[model samples]
Target chain A: MRREGSAFQGVGAVFIKELSDNISSVRMLMLELLIVLTAMAALYEAIIALRQNTAEDPFLLLRLFTVSQAPLPSFVAVLGFLIPLMAIGLGFDLINSEHNRRTLSRILAQPIYRDALLLGKYLAGLATIAISLTALWLLVIGLGLIFLGVPPGGEEIARSLAFLVIAIFYAGVWLSLAMLLSIVFRSPATAALVALGIWLFLTVLWPMLAPAFAQMISPPDPRYAALGLDTPDTAIWTQLLQRFSPNDLFGEAMLAVLSPTTRTLGPVFLDQLRGAVMGAPLPFGESVMIAWPQTVGLIACTIVLFVAGYILFQRQEVRA
Target chain B: MSDQKPEGGAASPDVVIAARDLTKRYGKTSVVDAINFDIAKGEVFGLLGPNGAGKTTTILMMLGLTEISAGRVSVLGFDPARSPLQVKRRVGYLPDAVGFYDHLTAVENLAYAAKLMGLSMAERSQRIVAALSRVRLLDVANKRVATFSRGMRQRLGLAEVIVKRAEIAILDEPTSGLDPQATLEFLDLIRELKAEGVSVLLSSHMLDQVQRVCDRVALFRTGKIVMMGSVAELAVQVLGAGFVVEVEADGAGIARRLAAIPGVGNVETLAEDRFRMTADRDVRPDAARAVVAANGALRRLSVDEPSLEAIYAHYFQASQSGGVRDAA
Candidate 1:
């Protein structure tokens, strides 16, 4: 069908409006402040924790993210817990509020197609996430400089930026999932609760359940049990099942980006480790390759959830 | 009461909107069952019906918001279902309950609408001012719409409609839940739009409301137009050459005595001292003689046709007797 305007004509308008709304909203402010305060505390603890591991450091800036003091998790772990909340907070009311306030029909009556509206909302959400993540990152870097009294090398900065991008991509999956729920459920409370339930299941319950599930699928070999050793096959299947969780993909990508000495994320046999020097850093490009599939998984999940939301929203009746 | 094609359209007064056997079905139920009509340029056409009479559904179909299950609707020479963008860009809609971004200022809301309409920054500011001033909202342009009253929101909605500069404005129950003054203002705004040659299609359940502004109207019942024409045409069709006489003759039994007359058919008593009588034949003289002969001094009398409500009731009864289920 021939359309009047370009497919993306109204996307820019919606993006600008939504971005301003997100940034100026009190909810985002509270969430950002929480993330920033936790980041500052975690970075401060990391500074004290990583003081002695200065010899032969290639990606030293990333140490700020992985190192932690007692009673406080690492910066990466804090982000893993906080980013989903921030993303869900931003998205849980995005579409349902339009319905509740009865503005959806008025907006849809405009000259643009449904494609622009959904795309615009998603892009605005991604932009907000990027801005908040970038600010938090710069704060961490600045804190590292003050406490450690040394600027990070270029390689460290590059690796840290890559980790930041991967983190944002991971958050996008939850954001898209939250938005899909928002479109599906008319009540914001229900949407937020369902999204949080899924997140909790995937992050906390899925890891414990995956082993039992994988054992049912591929149980340990009885012949290997006769040799007084459990088979690697069970571990391999459990790891494979665990990888389906976005949290695991995020953790794997974070490890590859922050610690170059880490070679493989999945099950690795001793034969594959031949001639590999322990604690030797891989090149920057190879580190990206190692983490590429995890990043792609996060991105693919985001796209799948967004497409589902878009289709449902488009098929809905505008009368309401 | 005559529904002549309205005048003052600078553009061609040809059909701006046309429907042919347009039907909308949900599963097996047809909500808008095979409706057909044409709205000319600058014409103020009314879709007059009570609630659940398919007025809103027909408007949705015409605007291409609802899918047409069968047949077609053409708005400005384009099939709305096929090219809805083109149709919507030129059509402005005021829904039953208008909504706006309450957190945004009035100007901000209109500016957003202008941006979606492809206006530039310079054009947006210029048109927003012009549109708001036209709707008498320029003084409160910078105020947040949350603080605005319902009438103000409705006016802002009209401003947004005008800022788009659409050729057609479709209003669904625009004056619902408004005070009489606000309703009059809303009607005046519609008249201004009509004067500017915008094809106006509004739906209402109020006969007087439609008769005041609409050039022509279609009375709908159960998703069908039971009778469609100007107010005069409907009155003539239902009450052909009938004279309804209201007589103020002081008596306790004027209504019964009027019904006992030779030609009077529909007798409604305004009071014990007043009676309203309608008849196919001329019964004014006989009615006056009967009143005076009843030893009741005739204080006042007037011979006029029945109101549109009475005509509607007649058509409603006609449709019910024809085995159409409760088409009122």
Candidate 2:
């Protein structure tokens, strides 16, 4: 039978409530603190390195995210590592906590379908990540201006903003993954542990293991190895394997956006670089075009994960 | 209480909820087998049964929170499965062990429900305060629910229903886990709801408490309703001998004289001065008159009223003995 009325009738209410709950939650606060401190430490190290170099590059502002001192990573690298953690923290308990608290049935009894609650919660998680990422982005820019004593060019500003948006999408991927786990596991602790385990495997193990796995599947050509050239088939296979991890997609997308000279994220043939200027930076639009596939990949991963969670939650019984 | 009950047939306008052949099944096992009942407007109907007796399953089916394997249920004239939002808009449900967000204040929690109900900001605050006051939770409106007791949380749940201004309230084991005083207080709130013309359908395993507030009750056994009607009617049906009258008196041959009264049967002497008998009707006046005429000193005379507890026990005992006495 057809259900009457819009399923989104209570979306606004659920969204507002979840947004406030996420922002005020103690776990969220701790995660936010960790992200800010680590990002600032990286940013400080980047500024020190940039100050010592006195580089005259036109994209010097963009270097704030990529430059690093010894024993410390760059601002973008720190964010790439921490964004997923924050997203998981925000969503690992999103649905199961309601079940544990015995409130799911009561809430579902309201004049709204499950669609509204799940959608609202996912949107709220995305919004929370967006707000924090934007704030952190602006803080970095402000610090760059004060410490470097140079105004950022319009392209640099545009590129960093693009990076900020990509970072939020990156967070959405992990948030959706965590929410899916929350729906699958009844215990919040179990969901959290499993989400963290997947995050570790994708971010740490996958990148290192992708090349070995790809080579095993498609051995490198002897002719290419003897000529001191990368094999085309193995490179393509490795890139495909790495693309399965959201971390790889997000990292590649950020790299393309923040470093305009980057033309491709995969292994390059000498012929592909022929006739290109040795160090000329691509235009802002061209950089975006280069990152477009990865950005879309991040968004697609988020949607697929969220849809999986939605289906599972819809079929779940409301009884505690 | 509305004495005019809408018997099994097409629903009357007075009926706020009607279930016809309502059934719920999991795989091959039917949890609720073709049970039918009606809740009239401004009346308190009870679904009484032990745990796992399909009471909760029936409640869930009515709210459309779970899939109905077969048959249909209408709440507020809308089929719950087809138009759940419409039915839910007018019906408030408090699931067993009703829960609230402990971190949120009572007002904040109720406000969320109010927003879900689409109440405007101005009306939301007004209704929230009014609901809290009605449930006697106004004093703790700003206190986090974690600091509140279980009874307070249950009251807060009731307040949420009040905020919705629902036409019908469905409570599943609302009084469970509450102290005797709290249970009484909660029942009073339910009575107040009935007084305000809100229909209530409450399910519970605690028979005595349900007997106190329910206008009519359906006794659920296994997946079917074994017996149903007002407490008095069920007593007459299950306990065919009817009312149990007790007399504390002093006289010669009082038991034999009490047995001679019209509509009285099976008089037995408990003590030299006490007697108990089964009567089809209230034989108190007749017994008193007979005792006075027989020159016996009448000290006390009372009847053991028909209680859901007795009816539930008698019906279950009879069924357990392999005598399936069908009384509905």
Candidate 3:
């Protein structure tokens, strides 16, 4: 083994080791098995709905695979809520568990940088989520084609793929955040709880409270506000308040993906088709770009948290 | 490996690790204060000390695992603080408690470590087998570590450290939890490491093990090396010219006469006839003549050098009485 090998190879090695270990874990296998069984049940239910003709929309059958999405908003809301929890669970203990096993010192004694450990664990988590999500997506699409007697149109296919990527990136953001938490906290249990608490706060409670909290903190004036005219001052303040929540960014990305008419408030890429054009739906690549800033922001936040954790880990004394 | 001479020195034997003024402090208290030492290639160097004596702290600094408050450390010609990656590549460290994934088998644990060390597939297999064999754990290589006894875990820990064939091995209390048989086996493996010219720094409170395996030992007390030298040299220094002479005297009056001798400091009667005397130097001949002149019979004359345990006790007592001043 020459020392001249690229440092990325070290990260690749760790990634492979983590991925193999994850697949071999009984707990992970059980979870995947349960997911597969659930998908089968959902498929059977979708087929029954299609045969009965009681269901007005056939696309509503996809809801059986996950939660009920009778209202379109409910579908977005359910996925938005569930994805972060899964992400947090997948990555909450990746680093701290190694520390608990006392293998951290030994692994670090190798000739690789500390960044490799963080990046490898992140990549492994991302890969696992991607594979699992892709499998489920294919299973649902397969069931849809067979039961509904309708192969998804190109637009629907495009939307599903776009949704899958968004879901993955959403999960990835949480995974990275959880990994960062794992590095910051010494105990795996504490890291998991903190990550879960953060997930619940952001996905469930924060959105519910943000508007009320914003109104209370910065009340709108009744005199001019009653004129039914929107003020730039109030609009800027509201936008600032909304940015405080990660859900807003995720919601914007989801809206851009699900609704053909919706466009993100940014300069449209003239060279490339921006958002989903009426006739020519948004391609997967174009969709990713529209959501690019949010993805990058989430990824950057993950990196910053991880970098801080890495610095702390490097400085920690491995006494026992 | 080629035998190239190290720069800035004669083609002397390779010194795998060296520390000059190596110091570590925790806030106001200095744990390891300005200690100078060098580990010669292939020698088993022991840092012998009581608890709270900063042995572990010193080892951590050498491994680049702890921040050095002051001083310099070089392992395998690489400065630990500046070039930690290079230092880590050539060094294998076994911390005090050798914890591992209990669910993983011995072979799996070693394989994981080997992979982390970037060993190739063929090299990993070879090294894993060799390490397991070296530690005498080859039979239980497939057994999960959770099922292993403490002694077995210690052996596995040793196996992991040597799996990389590192040039310098830093083991902190490597055999602390082992039984006599396992301890001996572990010592034998250490001896083998010495034969391969791998420098080993073993931190232990086991005086007997240190005496047997270490060529040179440093006795640390209150975050400082109170005494350091080869075992023989230490024995010579602590024991000095020594012997005790006990004479069977007539009565208390004769004991007084023996004490009155210019060379003898204090005298006491052991029984109805026997008396003991303390001498500042080897005054055996003079004391014997004096006893004879007083018609006292010499019952026993023996030379007693202080044991390593006694030397350790004496130095610790001296250090305490010296008002716990910091050591250089």
Best by lDDT: 2
The C-alpha TM-scores of every prediction are: 0.88, 0.95, 0.80
> Interface root mean square deviation of every model, in Å?
5.4, 4.3, 4.3
**Candidates' DockQ values?**
0.37, 0.60, 0.39
Instruction: Kindly indicate the candidate among 1 and 3 with the higher lDDT.
Output: 1
| Chain A TM per prediction | 0.95, 0.97, 0.75
lDDT for A103 (candidate 2): 94
Each model's C-alpha lDDT? 0.85, 0.89, 0.72
lDDT of 3 by residue, A1-320 (tens): 12333456478778887888777777577656755664455456546645666545434433433333232234345556655666677788987887787777667677776668778888888888788778877877887777666667676677778777777777777887888788778888899899888877876677667666656666766765789754434555565566555666777776666554444543234555544355444455666577777766666665676677677766666664
Q: Report the Cα RMSD per candidate.
A: 5.7, 3.7, 6.3
lDDT of 1 by residue, A1-320 (tens): 45455778799999999999999999999999999999788888888877866675656678889987888989998898889989998999889988887777778778888788888888899899999999888988988888877788888899989988998998899999999999999999999999999989998999999999988988889998999865788888998899999999998999998988889887788899999998899988889999999999999999999989998987777776
- Model 1 residue A279 lDDT? 86
Q: Pick the candidate with the highest TM-score.
A: 2
Q: Per TM-score, what order, best first?
A: 2, 1, 3
Clashing residue pairs for model 1: none
- In candidate 3, stretches whose alpha carbon ends up further than 4 angstroms from where it belongs are A1-9, A30-76, A221-243, A264-290, B1-12, B26-29, B239-306, B324-328
